[model samples]
Every structure is written in structure tokens, then in C-alpha cells.
Target: MLSLLLAAAPPALAHHPGADLDKMMGSEEKFFQIIDEPAAPPFELADADGKAVRLSDFSDKIVVLYFIFASCTDLCPIHSEVIADIQRKVNATPMKDRVQFLAVTTDPVRDTSEVLDAYGPAHGLDAGNWMFLTTRPGQPDGTTQKLSEAYNVRFEPLEDGQQMHGAVTHVIDRGGRFAAKFHGLRFDPLNMVLYINGLTNNVRKPAKPEPGWWDRLKVMFL
Candidate 1:
């Protein structure tokens, strides 16, 4: 519901207007393509164990949500690596307990539980706070893929058995609002971590102080 944008003057910014989050986002704000949409569409999908899991299951934590299939040899692999980089960083901090990384497969038929279970470790993703979720048995095919489309990602099946889809990392704030996104695999992963950190703390870190006259004078003298 709130859009996080950076303006020329911090105080004049709109949205959550002048909150600490605004301060923290600062120049790194460009990395987050903030959304002006409703709460993320809720869905009940199964994890690797076939147990039902919903978006609300992570209600108390910040979620880095993305989509991928194990067989793709293109952007999906790089996308997972990017998320893994951010995941490793988040896990190293206190935010680890407060953050969750979810990878929903677009190719549910080929990405079975065994494949889903092996995908994370193969991609260097830690298991502690991450899970590879998929459609459960008896569910219609492409059920979870449809969920990706709901998030504005398109999935076109190619004749080669691979999907043609754009890469995006969706950031869901603690309460399940589809708060922001990092579009494309080219964006910096650190920015993603900072955005999650801001969500975790509910405040942007204060901006760094500018150099004082005394410090400037000392620099000039030295």
C-alpha cells in the first residue's frame, strides 16, 4: 500500500513520508521497484513435504519471494545465485530469524519433491530460512505458476521444455503486503538485503552524517 521512493529532498518525500525507512533506503532506493498494489494474492501451496503452506504462514517474517524451475539453464540459475548471496548475508545477521526466502517453481511437473529438495543446496542456498515450494498432488498443473503470473510474471512454455519468463525478486513485508520488487537479475543483491533489514527493523537507518567544518579543516591541513 505504501510506495518507497527517494526524492531530491528527504523531508519532502511522499508515501510513508519521512520515516526512517526512507532515510535508510536513501540512494540505494533505485534497486527496489516499489509497488502500489494490494496485499499479495494469498495462495495455499505445498512445500517439499506436500504439506499445505500459505502466504500467511510467513506473516511474522519478511519474505524474499521469487520463482524458478530446476531445469532452466538461463536466468533462473543466476537469479537463484543472486538470492543466495542475499540470503547468506541476511542469515549472517540477526535478521536471519526474521526473514524467509521462498522459491516457487514454474515447472511443477518436472520439479518434484526430490528435485525441489536438491535445488537449494545445489545453488548454494542455505536450508535454515529457505524453502522450495511447489504444487501438491491432485492440484491442477501450473497451479503455482499461475500464482507467479498473479505477481506479474509471465511464463511461456517453450518447445524445448524450458520456460520463457522474466526474472524478478518480490519483497513481501512482514505482514504480507507485496511491498516492493527487484526487477531483473542485474540488480545488486546488497540492496535487497538492506530493504529486508529496513522491513525487519520497521525503520530506515539514519543517514550518515556529512563532514563537519572541523573535519574538513583537518583534512585540508593534513
Candidate 2:
């Protein structure tokens, strides 16, 4: 699976008091993994309006990132709908300002600006904090697909004009670290909302323990 592809990189350093916070946030252990060195591979792409958008642009917000093609008949639309549900839930809460959504096209060839622009509204995705990204005309054709691979989502074009791919929802923390991921289409959207809430409020429940010198040494070696 695409998630396995990212295992080559060293895990992100989990924050202190993570175990208590994880439980308090209601984060499902099976669906979400708190990366040790939480950071996402950076990329710059053009939105539907041709504006250059980069990951750094959202450094101050918690990013809900995913990949889809406008014409996809499977997975993409379902994922967007699920995200839309999550968006609505978040927007109803105070954490709305701290959260943002980004969907980059895997099939940039057919997902033109006009197509990309209409996709969100058609799928019930709110425009207030969401943006659909695609490669510009002069950019390489495989640009978005390469970006997907960088996020561990391997998008491959098949002869039938559809794509063979795995689905995952990436949650990038406010500080720009690729913090956590909710794998597959079946994960509850509320689970994501809870996780993002925990991130936004910096929930460090149960307090961080001060590691002893021996504990630090063990962490360095193990």
C-alpha cells in the first residue's frame, strides 16, 4: 500500500505527553499513526485560478491534504464527500480558522482549470477554506502525480483512463510537520475532526514527563 512507501523515512519525533493526548482526542490507534519526525514533502503548484500555491502557504493552519482527479468515478468523489462532511463539522466549531483543505489532481491532463474549479462545489466541498490544485499549462504533465508519490500516494494511469491508487487522508500540523494520517475511505470523518481539534488546541493532557538522563540515552540508541 502507498502508506508503506513512506516507511523508508525515519519516523517523526512524537510530542511529549502524546499517549494521554491521543486517548483524549479519541484518535483511533488502528487508523492514525503519530509520525515521529512529522513533516511533509514540500511542493508548489497552481490552483484553478493559476495562483502559485505551496505547502508553506498554510504553515499557520492545520492542513487536510488529499489527492483526486476530477473525472474519477471511484474513491475520489467519495473521499471528497467525506472531507466535506468533516469540513462542515469543523466549520461549526471554533477550530475552523485553524484548519484548511487541499486537494491536488492526480490526472492534471484532463482536470483542467474549469473542471477543477467545479469539482468542489459538485462534491459539496465548501469553498471557504478549500482549494483544488492542478498543474499549469507549461508545467510537466506528471507534476501532480509526482507530488502524490511524494505524499506516499502512488497514482498510476491505466489504459481504461482510470487510475489505480490507494486512498489516505494526511493531517499536517500548524507548524508544517506531517503529523498524522487517517488511512482509507472507511475511517470516520469525526475521528479526523477530533485529531485536528487536538492539534489546534495543542492538547497535551496529563502533562509531559521530564525524561531522566538514562531515558534520554535509551531513546538515542533505541
lDDT of 1 by residue, 1-222 (tens): 011221121332123212445344445556557673558878888888898888899999988899999999899999999999988777766677998999999999898899999999999999899999988778898898789999989889999999899998888887787778888977767667656755776643344434342232122112
Model 1 misplaced regions, further than 4 Å: 1-29, 36-38, 204-222
lDDT of 2 at 169: 88
User: After superposition, which runs of candidate 2 have C-alpha atoms over 4 Å from their true positions?
Assistant: 1-19, 23-29, 204-222
Q: Score every model by TM-score.
A: 0.81, 0.81
User: Which window of ten consecutive residues has the lowest lDDT sum in model 2?
Assistant: 1-10
Predicted candidate 2 versus true structure: per-residue lDDT over 54-107, tens digit per residue: 999999999999999988888989989999999987776666788999999998
- On the 0 to 100 scale, the lDDT of residue 138 in model 2 is 86
Whole-model lDDT, candidate 2? 0.76
Q: Which pairs of residues collide in candidate 1? A: 20-204, 21-204
TM-score of model 1 relative to the true fold? 0.81
CA lDDT of 46 in candidate 1? 88
Query: Lowest summed-lDDT stretch of 10 residues in model 1?
Result: 1-10
